[model samples]
Target: MRGVRGATTVEANCREDIFRRTTELVQAMAAENCIASEDIGAVIFSSTPDLDAAFPAAAAREMGWAEVPLFGTQEIASADGVARCIRVLILWNTDKGQGEIRHIYLHGAAVLRKDIAGN
Candidate 1:
């Protein structure tokens, strides 16, 4: 098994914005890493405290991940943490080596992991 990480930021605390950004993040991670829903064991999402209009996992379900287990939580408050951020950790059953995995970070969240963001 391996893990894929992704993060994105939204402009506001609204259901539509949250869902759109979360879905975009997940889709990008899947496309970049060649991930299929069936290969996913679980997905865990964390959002900054300022974003509370929707659960990021719900966006995964809308994106046809009904069988994949999903969870969501609020990120711990930190003075330097980025605001309106949604982060995801996906557990996947794959034979690929850890170094081969691609991590995605979009929008303002890109600053959080410049090494793995691949620009």
Candidate 2:
């Protein structure tokens, strides 16, 4: 099996907002890319330090991703990164080529990478 990488980002007005938006973004990415929930090896999520209502991973579990390995951390401040936003990096086991993998950068976070987001 080959490994595939996908990323998604969403901005939230607050911690509670992050949980909602992040969950939506992840689910949308999985659906758009046709990612099997079981095929996901691991997921790494990072939120801006300002967000503290809850771990975004908790939202993932609520979305029925209980068995998927997940970890959450804080994102270091960067002039370019969005504030009060959540970003995700998902590593999945798949036979698809890298070019076929879909990376979702949504909401205000779309500005992070114009090249990819524009498409």
Candidate 3:
């Protein structure tokens, strides 16, 4: 077995509208990476504290991922950190090697890490 990591971010117009968009972002990343809900070991998520519509993990649960391990936190505010945004680091199990793994930083988050986005 091997480990892989996937990441991504989504922007929300306001704190109240984050859940739907964030859910789309997470599900997109999982689908793009061909990750099975059961294959995901854990998912660590963060939202710019401004976002309070719901914990991004709540969206994951809405997607029918009850058995998956998940956690959520607030992203520290920085001059450069995107506002009203949600991000996640997915620790997954796969047979793929480190080089074969895909890390997804989508939506506005794409600009956050260009090096891996090309992959």
In order, the Cα lDDT scores of the candidates are: 0.94, 0.75, 0.72
lDDT of 1 by residue, 2-112 (tens): 999999999999999999999999999999889999999999999999999999999999998999999999999999999999999999999999999999999999999
lDDT of 3 by residue, 73-113 (tens): 98898998866667777888887777776667666667777
TM-score of 2: 0.86
- lDDT per residue (tens digit) for residues 1-119 in model 2: 43433344444455567677877778877886888889999888888767777888888888899899999998888877677677888888888887887778777777776788734
* TM-score, prediction 1: 0.97
Order of models, best TM-score first: 1, 2, 3
Alpha-carbon RMSD of each model: 0.8, 2.3, 2.4
Candidate 2: which stretches are off by over 4 Å?
A: 1-15
Candidate 1: residue 109 lDDT (0-100): 97
- Going through the candidates in the order shown, the clash numbers are 0, 0, 0
State which candidate has the highest TM-score.
Answer: 1
